[model samples]
Target: MTVSDEDLAIVAEQLGRAPRGVRAVAARCPSGHPAVVRTSPRLEDGTPFPTLYYLTCSRLNSYVSRLEGAGLMKEMTDRLATDEQLAERYRFAHESYLAERDAIEPLGTTVTAGGMPDRVKCLHVHVAHSLAAGPGVNPFGDEALEQLAQWWPSGECASKVKN
Candidate 1:
């Protein structure tokens, strides 16, 4: 997986900073812009960066932020305690995430992103995972994405950033 210079530039603008350890554009929006990126397990400086799939689109980030602001994290966390099937699926997602990251470079830690299996720490992470890994992978992320409106209809959020 290789990220083109154009994609990298767009992502940098989306993040408002230069992207580090971006291995590939894992997912793209409807308008063909980068939405999620697959990053290296460690930084170039050897720092452990466990976030494998990072969400870069500002519009998607805003939608996830809105969900976070609405206390969706707490609600999902609470549901995990009672929903055995959902919990099991989330645990699988966590394990898969760890495996993918370790395949790149072992971080020597079991801490997967988005507080998987036990909690819903960040909707952004979950949404990123869902977008990268696909549906039925991260239950919360799939649900949250389903709940949010189609954001790309307005315009490409990162279009002007590149121009």
Candidate 2:
């Protein structure tokens, strides 16, 4: 889980700013550019950062932001109100996320990011979680991935990230 200088540069380019508390590239695009990043449980400045996995790809971020703008989060949250199995799974996902983050560095807080175990707030966080941890771990993340189209091909960054 080492983050190379080139990886940081590529991620910074993808994010359009310097990323904070980023530990490594947790998930890469098909073109091998960073899609999601694993961040420190706490930032260098001593801020408690609960978001473990962060989506970095500009294209994916834009798509997920569009999903948020389209009210998909409200619909998903509505389902959580009526779906028992899904709610249980989401709760488990939240627990797993918290446990993983705690393993890295115990923050002593139960609050995980992305509104897990209750409501869907950020599709980008969920999707980044899904990509970092893999499928079946995060139900909301999985659902968001299912809805997003294959986006890597449209914005290949091999040239920009050439070593």
Candidate 3:
């Protein structure tokens, strides 16, 4: 999908700056605002940006941050150490992310964002990946998304964007 001017404006409002190397709108809010953006594996400056799915919705970001502050990452990490099936799925998610990124341009790195397969470091990245790739791709991301409040209750977050 093409990134429209409105999508750019919404992402700028969410990130406080213009986004670079945005490939497509990965996901949108209920009100049709850009919530997650699929970014290029390599940036315009030739920098290897491993983060393929980027969350651009401030409301969702704030909510996910709150979940992180609540020590959810620790709980999830502990579970990963014990749950074999969950760990396997998480590893698949990591592999999937790596494959997608490599398809764009090989970064020669195994470091997938959000600390996949081993630990949960950043909920924002996990949640973004989950939202972008859809359900069943990232377990941690699905869990984080489940914990978020109704961030778009009033409508799309873009409606709340200020000039």
Candidate 4:
């Protein structure tokens, strides 16, 4: 099997959630593709359970792992540092980046203060808004951020932010 397919198999073996498919009723649209869609593990009446509970749970974990290493925090924080305070800036940047405050609850009703995708998503929002000052935009330095981006996942994880 392909690398991602093999990895997905491993995740399936581990999470064991509900059937992992993206359909209209199941998801927002079966034929239509929805970005960043997450299915709940509940029945129609919200009383029963799903076939596989691993689907959503495993996907969530994968998202976190991928995003965490993407240097989302480091990259954003890089804009706000001086040559001397690069290290300290990035440290602060990483901490705030991982400190998400817009996470949805398990029930998908309320937003959590420090929920999953909070750090990554929130941090990205801050970056998009350009909320920091120039040369001192982020707390991290350019070199440190470059190192992080090189070392971490270089996929869309560090790109998108669902503000």
Model 2 per-residue lDDT at 141: 88
Q: Estimate each model's TM-score.
A: 0.94, 0.93, 0.92, 0.22
Off by over 4 Å in 4: 1-17, 20-37, 41-67, 70-109, 112-163
Which segments of candidate 1 are over 4 A away from where they belong?
152-154, 160-163
Ranking by lDDT: 1, 2, 3, 4
lDDT by residue (tens digit), candidate 2, 70-157: 9999999999999999999999999999999999999999999998879998889999999999999999888888888565335564
Per residue, candidate 3 scores C-alpha lDDT tens digits across 7-79 of 8888888899989999999998877889899999889999889899999887788888888899999999999
What is the per-residue lDDT of model 4 for residues 1-163, given as tens digits with 9 covering 90 to 100? 1123433343344345332532212111122211122223344556422221112222233543454477655454343344435445544544433332112113333322122122323332222112222235343223223333444223332121122
Question: Whole-model Cα lDDT per candidate?
Answer: 0.89, 0.88, 0.86, 0.31
TM-score attained by model 1: 0.94
RMSD of each: 1.5, 1.7, 2.0, 13.1
Candidate number with greatest lDDT: 1
Q: Where does candidate 4 have its weakest 10-residue lDDT segment? A: 26-35
Q: Write the per-residue lDDT of candidate 1 for residues 40-71, one digit (tens) a residue.
A: 99999998999999999999898889989999
